[model samples]
Target chain A: MMKIVLGSLEKLDFRATVENIRVVESVEQLSKKNNEEITYFLTETEENINAVVRNQEHVYIPATSLLASHQSIGLHIYFDLESYPFYQKVKEMISKEDKPKGVFRFRRTVQHNRNHSLLTGDLYTLSSLLGKPQDIRVKQTDLSVTPSHTIILMNFGGGTMAHIEYTVSDRERIELEWSGIKKIIEFDSDQMVSIQSTRKPTQPLAYSVDAILASARKVDQELIDRLNDFSRLINGGVYS
Target chain B: MKIGIMSFAHMHAYSYANGLTRLPDVELVGIFDDDIDRGKEAAETYHTTHYSDQAGFLALDMDAVIICSENNRHKEMVMHAAKAKKHILCEKPIATNLADAQEMIQACKDHHVILQIAYPVRFSSPIQQLKEMIDNDELGEIIAFRTTNRGQNPGGWFIDEDQSGGGAVLDHTVHMVDIMRWYLNEEIAEVEAIVDSYFHEIDIDDAGLLTFEFANGVVASHDASWSRFTEYPSWGDATIEVIGTKQTVKVDAFQEHLRMFTNEKKSLEYVFWGNDMDFGLIQDFVNCVKEGREPSITGYDGLKSLEVSLAGYESSKLNKTVHL
Candidate 1:
């Protein structure tokens, strides 16, 4: 059995709020304050995540990188938007807009520690909603030293236009349009599973805890891959 | 606690009356309406006395009055009730304009009585939960907001500019704007809007899209309209979507329902089941009066939210953003 030591929290039973995993258990090693014996740390941002493994050389994989492990969270067409809930309302708005674009502007926070920026995470999960993107472009709105607020517009294969907004804000949502028929996704934390959208009679998108473990195996699941891909794309991956 | 209702002009008075009935400790002392027949009918339905004279009703041994008068008549009713030393719960879009709303608020303050605005949507448990989360900063720093409060056009005085103030923008905008402001704890910095009579033949606007930038530069856009026509499954919806650095939260406060396909005349209906927003508001008001505390939804909140809807009209007319 792989030894997993918990942090901040004394113990947690994932029997509820998550599915398909028992890798989590209360361990004796957590009480041993030597600091070097623990190989895996399961902690939240409030637990002082930086002081743990993230600040040191123990290797830190943020929720954005870890949640990207599953291909079901992958960029593939589940079905047309017609099959989606609120179909008529979405259809009515689409017909009204001559461009017929579906925007998904959302924000992602970076784990800043001097030179390194937590490169990739939320964009991959939200981009999957529009299926695989046929093309992607970056438009930086706010002038900052470290791309503090960036507006990335994507053209998906299914003809949906997504605008991904990144910055510090008190809320998070995936909108169909800036001000049209929209679907807002609420999360307690970024690593939440069995997620429920509050309205539009929001459909819950659930993932198994096993997928989180599967994500650890795929090194490319790190946000760094998307950042590299964006660089390559910007360096002429495809010409308009 | 003894509470009387003033005016049967706004239909919400009926719901407020029903809410009064649910509370074991509160009594519906009487009702006063400019329309005698309407007041009498409501009094009979709620099993309360009807006072045709506004002075007669205000003179009653009541602790508070719920003013469900016309949008234009709110100021008069509120002022009368305040001087009578009765705490007030006035309906949304507190007055037709800012000055009246301000004066109404000031009178309540001077009289040292509680003045609550009837923004029942905030009593929603999910919305309350979201507010708690926002208070705790569970989502991080909130960035932008998108909201919708669409409803079927209730014909009658609601369409009359003199009685109802404005159309869809006035009727539907306050509830959501009040919620947004409460959640962010911020005042609007600017307003931009497009208002038109697209759904109806009325001169007053039946549709509007309002955009607001808060004092902190947090932006929000609200689609307030009376576009939900007859034969729709429900009367309307109150939906909100917010984006923050941490996560997004979206809620349709009235979405708790079972869709019913009926063979009856009404055809489509949503059999709603959830925490009663009106009852909650009534209970809170009763608690405020009993506990001698401040109201949950204050007159100042009403004034600020009203300021946005009023600005919307000006923004549409000027074809430019109205800076507050």
Candidate 2:
């Protein structure tokens, strides 16, 4: 049996999904578990990650360990724009790109007054994707009577440009327009991703949560399959 | 109701003038712009008379005047309208600064004129539904908001700091800030922001990320950037994510649009299909004038939102959080 230990359950809504796995309350108990046991650490503290890594005899997974197993996992690392320092860092990093070429626009519309740090996570991902160019420039312009109805233009090297327009005064939809692509991707907060493309002019994909979940599951399963293969190679087929 | 447009500097004057013509029992009396040629052109386009002199424009027997002047000139036009005792629907930000905004509000109040700020996003149907949900506590206690109000930069006087006051920070922060204040019914206590002139070869800053702390402990962040490209499918978007203790909701005001790709344009374009928010806003102002009721979006609302934007600029300059 595959016995998995969870470090912390606070604020985690995925508890029900992990019901089949063995969950221990304390790190001591986790440490005592057999080498075959897999431990998952979800806390933000560096101490917990250190504790797990220190126990080299056992197989442990930090929150970020799974990130390397997949490409899109980086998108899940929420960027907290609420923190002043982090916001500045992000701004600086995005500005550092010299002659960056590409259009990256992120427009997020929300329903109430809430913390948005988590929503900006994709900014880093987008910046990373665009790479460093010869020059990058950013400009903000206000275009509407509504407060906060502003657009941010990012000019990368060459003719590539990215625009992010945000308005709390409007409805809620996360829309992204990329250069060289014939379609725009609209991500609903409910985890539904729809493609509005010129190729399928008449068949705009309706927002569907199941479709997104299914795609995410496929990626997750691929990661799991790779882990299973690694386990088998390390500890013989018995672990598999 | 006989109404006059104060200036043609801002492009919305055309839409407002056209909307007035479509409204029942409302007359677009005349067009008044500082530039005689521009004013005359707008008047001809709207089939109205042009008034070159400020005194002559105010002297007209008008029920109200819509101030669509440049950012710096809003105070002068609004004060003039107030003196005329005409119910006013002034454009956003109220004024370029807190002092100017307060003066405009006080003048309107002293003159017994209804001062409504043009915030059409409040009139969006999806936004109204979101407000209803918040009011009903469907999301439980509100926690924070992440919003973006972005659009393509309208180059011209907009890029000139003297004419427009500030760039994206000043122009963009007010709309979503107004919505946030209305939804949470709380004042913003703190602000931290980053404003940069990273795009375009302009003198003014065009991109900004503003964070806020509400008096009620709710925190929010906004991306008020004029960052849209010419090839963008639509003008831009107004999007917000409402995070509450119990649940979260997202509102995208411009999502209800149809995508079209034609040979003439060569690129894809989004044709919005939602109800005309501008029409709703103008109708509300007209109804308030006729019913003798205070406008739903008041001058104070404009002042409060403008304060946040001004604070954003202060925060950027100081590289620290500003207390409202």
Candidate 3:
């Protein structure tokens, strides 16, 4: 799992901001005292401007050239930008006053996606409509083949900022261009399997959970049938 | 290579000056903003020369020039650079309109010069890797994708339609559109989008959404906004996600350096914010110029992206789909 440590001094009182940002050291010590291990470390943002994050083993400092005042204190582990979700969610929950002086921090893991597309009926239709080409013939079924390493950058709040990508073969492709004022979703083969249904007012939670559980119970049978079909198609017991 | 900046009117001009000075092989030749005070300030802070006119600055004999001028002024700057035959790095939305952008491209081509639009995201390491994975068929097929560039309102000249061409969509949409074309390696066949003023006091739309359908049956959505309030911890970011037949991957390309702290009675806190895209972009432009190659994102890419942005504006006004 990729971990990111972020700190910011939005409050004019520098002492309080530094004090708040120093929590990473304690967190590191806590990881050592306990069995929780630290894998990768990234030192970015203003905290590292004064050589604050240095000489630490496995710590990677990408760039310090463009550091600016009046921004957030943060660090990112690994180069994958997707791992910053916990910080974003925590940042979103923060109130204006509590942001600086009122110490508040939270952490959450992004549930790695395992499904291709978890589209509602409306979303599916809209997606299909958008896929049509005026000069050429395009089929929805043809678009069904999965690209690897899909990412969906959605704006929970309304804005013209979202990103989606996929890796087909070894080439990373930007499947969608940035358009303003729209919802965004990115999904590919490996990440598609984990997409559980989103909860909604119309659908009761208990009912959806039960339905999902029932589907899970059939996995064994489904696997057996799929294996049998493959064997028959291949004209041999390839499993041996 | 010694590089200098010509203007500080663009949002990215200050960072370009800093980056040029920071790179090992590059020396900062100084910066010049049309506004004399702005030029002097950037020059003093960046420790470079501040020239009052193009002739004086071009005569400084710098290896390259970055035109971080207004959208309307890009062609003139490029023409001057063309006459000088110096390599040029430029900001995105390369021109206020398509004709001007074309002229800039032509001038560079005629002069046998490198004209690279400073679309740093194309040079982003992770994005480069993502492109590789997609081309390799690790994912079976690209089903769909979405992208967005949103942030706090950029007032001043950005609000003027003549100065900026349009509002949020115009200012922000081109980069994403270019990224999309680069990723798919295909043309955008048709598009439908909406532009509107919401939560902004300006005459133009502070928010917009565009939907695109590629010829390959891959669907896309792009969102651009400048209405986000700065009171929020961070303003906004450029993010992309691609959904394929088999899996999903998301790119959070927002640049920030942050830290947190807590004591006996408290919790999380923000220590700093470092949002820098120019460092990578400047390095890329210099590399391309040194190597005698076109940029990963070229001026033509800027023109196409701007076309998509403008198409969205037209679609929203007409409430109809557009073919590109």
Candidate 4:
């Protein structure tokens, strides 16, 4: 399970039998890492599209590297028709014998002028298959006098990574940036009031046919049939 | 058919009048209010005949009379509409009390007239979308919900307990509760609330924090307050966030535009200014009247929400939970 980073490939993880490793400058030196056996890597390349179409088995795309590649090479994300091989890997990591769990102190505070008030406070569950250090703490803090502020403290088994801080004076024009960490994928909250980074250990998944079918199992068959019909209508963009 | 507005005291009365004019089938017949000056002024501006007396106004033979009178006067106005055999469009919290609301509903029912409560959010497109999403389980089984129904403290009749029923909890709580019941299509089994009068220095509670437990183990909390100040330039704001096992779905019932920003700090940009949902509601009322169908937010629906508000108030008073 690799955490996708937006900019650099500092903390990308690729767990596979690293068949062979060689620091090569050219295509000829890239031969050892090339074989029928596929290996996942935390690096992006310019030849990804052609490499995949040619079925170059040894070449691998890192999850963290995809965002940049997508932007640079116009690598658009579509429905994963053929479930990527990474799903099995993630599932295995999730069910592994030695898993680490930690708790995060989630606190949301709103500050206006000299007044600071706590909006929400809770403890959250955090489990990781990634290697854990002796002590890992993830948290957010700021001193700027803003109308509101949200702080999340992730007590991870590994080192802490805090990425984003946002403030709204007028709530119309927003300014966003990343510090302490760069590469991350953020999802919009349901209210569109906030954008939150997906918690570690979970990958971003939008609704699709598989989810629809899975949930529809105990539901009414007539409703299932209607939903199935709807899926087709939406995907095909044809009413009938 | 020619339509006539009876009062301009409540803000909703203007919305209803505007909605009526938007329909091709109805025309503005006349306008009247107990306050002669305000009634005459609105009539002149909206271009409708100004009636001096309540009796004279009803004599216009209008198809309906939308009772947007003061909250306390709802019963009298509704009874008058029922007696006139006109279809009734009553502003919600239907009459400040269950007995009055029930009587109004019965009066309309007995007279064979449509009693449509003006819970305009029921007619919103986003709310309809939220309904579809929940029905499809786009959000898995809903575990909890947090709702905010806030507006500027328009004190007058609204703050006066005798006039506006009880205050913010009474005037504002019904809309969100009705929305909750409508969205879940289920009855709330129990309610616990902490209601207070924090915003305005009033004797009655102007804010309510209520937690509702549905029969299906779904828990929800509502924030109904008259805390929006005039400096904000917003009359009211309503939003609901529903959390489920797998996902969350929210409806910004009051606004439309969504914008995002991040610089020295990140923030969201939300503005709900452009569209008019009131027209949709009134249009539905007209369509229902013509087609002989029940209004989307019916009298029964209004009663159910009022019941929840009443229960919440009772819960707060008793300092204990109430079983609905």
Candidate 5:
């Protein structure tokens, strides 16, 4: 049984969300550290059964998209779902294979001098249509030696495009747009963060939840590799 | 002047009939339709006599006949009307085959009658403005064209290959190609296309993405499809994006609409309040008949567009770009 530990207060709400889950064997209390860094995803490791998410600062999400709960076929943990402000109603999504047309707007807030990163929600949303990032870019601000803002743009071919802007703020918020629907997800506070679905910001689409999650995870790993290069350039150390 | 309609099989017949009503100089003498119920209904709607026999309808004292039959039947209807010495306004894609289109053109000439093809897009205000821009050198020398003609699948004879000649590609490609040729005064030289039945479960192709080069070395891309879902705000769209040396202009022919969100059948609706293109077409045909002049859109214009559209299908079948 792969054991995932949610930070501090989510023990009850996590159970409530995945109460009908059948694939998950058990949940155990892992280490509870109070590190308010990034509130996103960590993929399940093959050997390490215990995964720790630091503090009320972040929610521990296994590599999965938001619509996975509706699909019930994959191993997914429902957490921080109600916290997002837009596209909370996943049931009303159009599930057909609609090759998304038009531009994508992706926004993420980082506390550090975080230039740019694709947030988990839009990562899944985009990765569904654009399998692997054919291209990933971080615009050079040149405003300061340690610039605090980052803008990233990705092209999925056939005019399907996405742009992500990372602005350094004290809090965490993420936004993404597909077609006419814009999905914005963020924390109301540092305590219990509930991810909301736009059912803002959208008429949700039922992309292959697990497939999109897997795709998003692959893309995230690529971004991390790119960020690692940035870390070496700035701090001369690998970014955690 | 008195005018008559040959068939009500094509939906445009109703609009053309209404155009006849809007004109003070013309009178709709009668209507003839092979489909008896359709003929009777249209006759009642337009307040005209229904003539079941094609010969009897041709014998009426009408100066012209608007042929709105199926694609395959257009040749026969136009022939009969031309022999009767009635100036003809035939629905587009002239005929199912080039030979038939040639024969229709010959028949009109032999009978000394005007043979006009109903290509209403030219009459659209935006299309006219684009032509004006080109004439005035406002956009400099024309470079390229990107156009889309997508409509909701008018299921029925439109989807039947036997009656309609082809599907969305054939139904839509002709209109845009006609306009493009008129604008550039160039013939299509090459065609490469990807055609498939993506929108509907039917066997006929409902989508076609076509790319071709005009004689003047100008490349053009056309997206023709019946992929618009039922709940879509508007019926469909015909948009042209013209790339010029000085400026690039994009015009959505049906963009003059009010977006309304109400609880009436559809949650979102686009009520179009644009200029009536059909009326313009009918008016032009009437002027040609009275003045004894060739129409702005003639049978050859229809034939050339049909040739390019058919070449797209040939390219798809051969899986290689075909030269015309």
Candidate 6:
């Protein structure tokens, strides 16, 4: 059985995803869920995680970024844009194929605001898609505003490092870029991921939603598999 | 403006030197380090002269010196620079202890030198904007704060208690505490802390959580830990959430970058692309020197921040709340 405990009850689309899955609004109702049931939380606090853990319910954390983890993750969503085509081109470049050689580094700085939880959630999702990081470092550079900014540095070992700057600003937009020893990648959320390699003077292939979505699906499957293994372990059975 | 970097012990000296060289009106006079090899290499990299003797470097007729020495050595360097009547821009926590910090401040005061404490976050564009909003009452009256300044354990002298004074609590706590003081314009009254060396085999504490009570009734919590793993992104973070009576504001000072996942590296990397806080801070220091004005961030600011960290240590030792 699958159940969702949403902080709000207004979202109806989520209820239709699975037929046998139950949906609830409060933590009280979610805690009463059977041990065999899988529960997804839309928004949960440390206190809530503790409560669920104590209740012994099989909890699957979907929003990994929001909750503070061993690794630092950050995300920011901006809605303002001047040109759609330009944005599309940028997005395509970020999701491009001819990947940069050597260590890849990424960072984002936003204006301070009150949406840190959401930004963290987005980072968590992105990190999940990337793969498990070997090491994680998070620094809170400044925190005098509502959406306090943090610099999350992740080293995936074997020379892969990521530096993210989470910013909260009045302006709404997205920008992405990658810098390597011999290559550079740049993209916007709606644009293509573009790769510029020194060795390959010619333009490299770009990536779009189709590619990113596939990766996202893969991450989702991995999470589910891990959760299943965890359930099996708790039930005193080995995962098959 | 003429500036000489005192040491190359801190990695930030590289970035600061780059910033110094970029200014049209400023000249990076030279670099001095007790370790001649490191100093010579850094000077060569930045295209500046390297001085082996401390006295020789102090007598170079520079208007100011940037001290990037180890934390414990700050007092001695500051004293030497101040005696030479050179203005100083010293790295954070001014000194390891209150006595040392006070002595450094006094030395600078006696010599009539500008002692600017390096609090680069104050110069960050986003942070500056947020400071303005708070000043304008955009967030109304502030109620509380949840701040974190976490980074990966920087081994070597940073982990050595004698050189660094303490570990995460001393190295990380002051940065966020300084910001809190700047935002609230208040001082910490009482402190409670839990410090431990849970992650590494360090003798000093590597992780800490501190709760502070301000005189103005604003309570704040700080997680100053070197809890980040080696593979974690960036160096670390300094994040703050200001909960006000009207609304809450979150500030992530280092959140300007691009995200890249490459198969070649087989890992995700975040490439930061934000206004350089170090550049702005150096610019401010240069401007203050040229204009003969006090830097916005002074030695007193460093002292106040250091006090909180010191209090945190005391609180942890006593296993109870410590009053300032």
Residue B6 shift from truth in candidate 1, angstroms: 0.6
What TM-scores do the predictions have? 0.63, 0.66, 0.60, 0.58, 0.63, 0.62
* Tens digits of per-residue lDDT for model 2, A78-97: 22221122233434444555
Off by over 4 Å in 6: A1-240, B264-266
> Which residue ranges in model 1 land beyond 4 Å of their true spot?
A1-240, B263-268
Computed on C-alphas against the true complex, the DockQ of each candidate is 0.03, 0.05, 0.06, 0.02, 0.03, 0.03
Residue-level lDDT tens digits of model 5 in B142-175: 6567677877889989888999999999999999
**What fraction of correct interface contacts does each candidate retain?**
0.00, 0.00, 0.10, 0.00, 0.00, 0.00
Model 2 misplaced stretches (Cα beyond 4 Å): A1-60, A63-240, B264-266
Which 10 residues in a row give candidate 2 chain A its minimum summed lDDT? A207-216
Best by the TM-score measure: 2
Answer with 1 or 4, whichever has the higher DockQ: 1
Please tell me how candidate 5 rates in CAPRI terms: incorrect
lDDT of each: 0.65, 0.65, 0.55, 0.55, 0.66, 0.66
Candidate 4 all-Cα RMSD:
18.3
Better of 3 and 5 by TM-score: 5
Comparing 1 and 6 on lDDT, the stronger one: 6
Error of 5 at A103 (Å): 16
Worst 10 residues of 4 chain B by lDDT: B260-269
